[model samples]
Target: MPAEEHPMIGVLLNGRTLRGIRRGSTQHEALQLYEHAAARLGCRICYFRLRDISLRRRQVKAIIPDGPVGRYVTRMIPIPSVIHNRAIHLTRRAQARLGRLHHLRYYIYNRHTRYSKWFIHQLLSKHPDIVPHLPETRQATPTAIHQMMERYDTLIIKPSNGSIGRGIMKLFKDGGRWHLQYRTAGMERTLRTRRGKRSKRRIRTRRWAVISFRSKLPAALKRLIRQRRFLVQQHIPLACYMERPFDLRVSVQKGDSGSWQVTGIVGKAAPAKLFLTNVAQGGTVYTLEHLLAANPSLHPERVRAEVERLALLIADHLDRHLPNLADLGLDIGITQLGFPMFIECNCRDLRYSFLEGGLWEEWAAVYYQPISYGQRIWLDRQVTSGTAN
Candidate 1:
């Protein structure tokens, strides 16, 4: 099929990503991977922002590829009915635009990427199978925090809308005193290389502080929770790798047949003594097999099978309950006894762990899955409307 004649699928991006593309920067996103994946799947992709669409005209000024070149050109095209929304727009006006698009009968998967963590926990709580895996969670009220602290020796207090392990705190009791450990916002320092080629990088050195007090919650911690919506959950004693706590980031996504699939699983080990295993927070990525091998008690085959089953079940359950969800990154923690514990769910999964873990095959497939899934939806609609090419 000719490139121009292939079915067009939309890749909705955030304003930052659109501007980055316009500025010839693809750092914030892997635009090349998306382009390559679309090409491999025999589909044409249009990259556009929500504001680029004109609802009245039903057209979008989207960026499309030029013939045999890596360059892109802007052109007007009908609003693609099949849109994969990768942006998280929190403003009401932005949300209104999304609602309007849906009203216009656009097929937008992952229409709402961000969801309240507390809300999702409640949704999963209703399910019996999931309940066993869920860590006890509650809205971050003073009473809830106090009561939960009494039940568990350690608790995690984090913002409901947080991502990449930012704004997370660890509360634990030891030696007749309670300790609060959290990362403080620190300045970024850039190091220059021996060669004169200067490059900027965020300083990996994180400043973590520990505060201690007796019995009652610290005024500082209490004030922090009051500032925004937060969730206090029981801290799962995650099984460790090299004696450092780690968690598995499972990429569950829709495949070409529009069915949920476990695309990849990678282990993220936290920095020494840190409570976070988020990649952005300097966590080291390792192959899931390697992590399981280090923890000898867990049977490799049994643990692998259990993780897959649990990931699929969660994805399927969330798909039925949530609206238009096709991709999810679940942070699943395993106990020393190999029990899978659901830590957190990320709607926008940044899939660097696969690449970092040297799983090139899975890394490539993560990029291919979304476009392939989009192609599936577009073809299904075409068949239904008798417009198949």
Candidate 2:
């Protein structure tokens, strides 16, 4: 089939150079996924950085493969009918550039903030069903921290824009003192003996140190608060697997029918003694079935049904606010009492958890669903133009 016969679909990426033919590049991986789906859906797909688009020419200099298992070639193709954004970060300049291409539609619309806990809390607060799942959260002011600490036995202080469990501090009152635990880049530990008993090891590091301090509020924590804004959330006692804290990751995507559906749900277990279950933070992924088996006391079917229902509801609700959202990766924590808690939502969700759990079919669905949605948009445009003519 000729490329001209199909509507063009542009995959917006982060980098300047295109490496669709080179293995391990964002363009390469995206091209590989889009190529198969484009063939089936009858679309011409190309990978282009945001700067590659030319409004004057009404075309994009994109990296496109010559053929299957062939070299990559650059071509000035007509501006895409739709764009599937996979860029992790979009600058103001890039946003202005994309804004110029107002005629093209987008699957994943805008870059969402990682500090969106408070934003989402406010959005979901209107609905009673979702409110219970939201933990008590507030802007990390001194007063807010004091209030939260007074209310809850344990509190979590994390950066408003943090990811991969970075800049997170778990605080709890142990007897008369407050204890803070957090992860850092690298730290040296030394064992000291006090009164003929081995004392708790002390850790020293120049950078963000993974250590615990017993005091009212450490100087480091105060510096952290003074440096940038943070969020103080009431920590929930999440269920555990083999003594490691675990949480459920529900992947929801808009299907070809334009309805939200749960694509995959897997459990992520943190290393022992760790508070976070982020896979990037040395956490392990487990199948839902495995998680259910580990906790036989809870009804597996009931939990699965409830989680799916909640995930769909969240996706639908968020869609009202984010109209162009094609998919979401929801981090939901199931408490020991079997209550579901919303941890966070990722607009540009990482799909490696699905792949790690041997869910290739579901992972593939993530790539293909956007293409199908884009194809529908293209077909609608053609129909509208034809009818006008």
TM-score of each: 0.93, 0.86
Deviation (Å) of 109 in candidate 1? 0.5
lDDT at residue 140 of model 2 (Cα atoms): 88
Local distance difference test values of all predictions, in order: 0.87, 0.73
Of the candidates shown, which would achieve the greatest TM-score relative to the real structure? 1
lDDT comparing candidate 2 with the true structure: 0.73
| Ten contiguous residues with the weakest lDDT in model 1 | 196-205
Give the residue spans of candidate 1 off by over 4 A: 1-5, 22-24, 187-206, 386-389
Model 1 Cα lDDT, one tens digit per residue, 1-389: 67555778898998888878867785547777888898788898989999999999999999987666468899998888889898998999999999998887788889988988998899898889999999999999889988997899999999998998999999998997889898887777776778856668657556899999887778887888888998999999999998899999999999898999999999999999887998888899999889999999999788877888889999999999988899898999998899999988888888778888999888888888989998988888888884432
lDDT of 2 by residue, 64-123 (tens): 867754457788877676677777654677656655565343333433323266677778
